[model samples]
Target: MIDRSQLQTVLESDFLERSFPVFNSPGIKDEDVMIHSLGCSVWNTLGHELGFMAVVEGPAPIASGNDIRSDSVWFDKADNTPLVLIEFERYDGTDRGYGKLEEKLGNLMEASMRWGDQPTLLVLSAWSPGLVSAPDFERLELMFRRGFSNSKGAKIPAPTNCQLLLHRLVLSESHTGLLQLQRMNFRWS
Candidate 1:
């Protein structure tokens, strides 16, 4: 069973590390080709590393039977269960990022309700390089934790391993196509 910590590591090494300035690069103007190809490549790399099958814009694994396409979904090698569902949101502005984040949370929450009891990692990977400050991540985490109600009735009770990872991109002159991650990992109850 893969724990949240292990999931964090894989997300960092396999996905985040591979998808850099290209993924979250503020420098790039034309992103037509890079967005299409790199998105699939990073997830493919992640799926290969963890022995899972990854797809971009694939249908979500919610039991609701509604057609919901997630940013990324990872299935078990046997091609049965979806072990992970990720939603990527670009941190555009102060007011905009929150709405996008909340929308992404809804996607994860639906999947969490369906598969949170099992070993699943519902991730909201946001790209906020210099837009969002460091301390605001705490506020973001608390805001997200509220999405999962402690009592299970209206709001789905998040799994013990429910985590929100906010990616802060930091550019370094040494690496040409790189922006390092300053991550704030929060475990929601």
Candidate 2:
């Protein structure tokens, strides 16, 4: 699997050049864009402030009974399409935690609506698994489908135009990380 530290470094650098603007609108002051440090929370480059609770910590599931924190970076499309919500799941677990994944997805859907008409793109990233099975992956895929449908059907506007993307990162035998991107889009009636 890819070294977690190396991946984290790349993400941090990418955020400043490509991901900081979505949350750092002109109306909001630079001080308002709180970024938490990598351990259990997100931080700005200076490592000074705590971001929105849900953005730093994954949304507390109304029912999942786990308030696990997630790593997310919010940014607007430079082309002005909408907001991009990126959630990174770099678990050291042998089996990827679908529960945490669902909770993060839930948070992204709720958070995106607050950004107005801007459509949201939720991306889930992860590392290679040591003990995950084909069945487990299948189950996670089905769960994601259900979550995507329900999130689209939320009381928000039907035409919010939200989309979902799964960015899978796997470490090969050569210790190089392979990137795979998959897309999912849904709209509620």
Candidate 3:
């Protein structure tokens, strides 16, 4: 089981305070640069929150039958055991579309399969204000409940022990200098 309160505490801390400034810096208009910078910020914040000493791009082929690559993987600071697998999806305000959301769901399913029965967290972090709406989130949640399938009808069952956390980062102009992080309650069972 996930310690929701602990995770909430970590998120509510000064993590965003230290992370979002990277975007406010000059010359961050490039989409790739913004994505990479946000990934790094998230990696650092997860390390601090989870006591992870190493956060690498991936432990590729996290499962035996598949070749999916996780965006980042966390390791324990002391023993170096895998702790979490993170997948990041960023949407520029212009492209608030469902295609990206479907792609992200596929990635999450792959990560969940790789995680198996481990206590590791599978984080699906989306940095888009448009993706944070209730209907959009519900649609994503439904995908998780239904599992993944190919166009030809082959199906992959969702992992039983894969605890998922959907972290949605909404950048609002109303909050002049703040990036709001909303944790959507997505049930895996």
Candidate 4:
């Protein structure tokens, strides 16, 4: 098992190189490609037959609820009006998070292109590595591990900007993992 520092480094690095495409075109059926891609059949990098991605509609916004929060995130309240909001879910109780993140990232990039303002806020919600042991955890954990160091002579302030939340739930035969997540809110000004 990788240590916390190594995991953080891997995740941070991936995030830095990662870019989300935002698409904003009139009459465009797939206004949100990444979001729509959820449950859509696609090919993985290794050329494997993928399953349908899951998509979630406008998630109910409520303050003070299980796995919920109200914060100025993932939107440009300064100039760009409320154009759109994207909420990701982790289906299969894995790191995939309702939909494939790659598509969502692509969609974010598309949105950025159409909109004049750069992303101001970012909000990411997903289970953590140590808790979920998700398939994606290895990647994120690798990122985090390599980026940050508990050893002597390490840099301060990691690359990624996000917060983690832990939710304790009853364990079952099928589900035996802690609920961990990281939320990021993106916006433009």
Better of 3 and 4 by TM-score: 3
RMSD of each: 5.4, 12.8, 4.5, 18.7
- Candidate structures ordered by TM-score, highest first: 3, 1, 2, 4
| Cα error, candidate 3, residue 171 (Å) | 1.4
* Whole-model lDDT per candidate: 0.55, 0.39, 0.58, 0.27
Badly placed stretches (over 4 Å) of model 4 are 1-78, 81-86, 91-99, 127-131, 135-189
* Candidate 3, 64-177: lDDT as tens digits: 455666667776666656566667766554445556756666765765565553535667666654344432656666677678784445576765656667765554322444
Candidate 4 structure quality by residue, lDDT tens digits, 1-189: 112333234333433123211111111122234322421211111011111121233222332222222111233234433222232333245444533433333333233223332332222233222234333434433333234322233332222322222111111221323221222222211
**How much is 176 displaced in model 3, in angstroms?**
10
Residue 147 displacement (Å), model 1? 3.2
Clash number for each model: 0, 5, 0, 62
lDDT of 1 by residue, 97-170 (tens): 67667666666666656664442566665554443533355665665566653222356444455555554333
Clashing pairs in 1: none
| Candidate achieving higher TM-score, 1 or 2 | 1
- Residue 187 CA error for candidate 4 (Å)? 17
lDDT of 2: 0.39
Q: In model 1, which range of ten residues has the least summed lDDT?
A: 167-176
Cα error, residue 153 of model 2, in Å, equals: 16
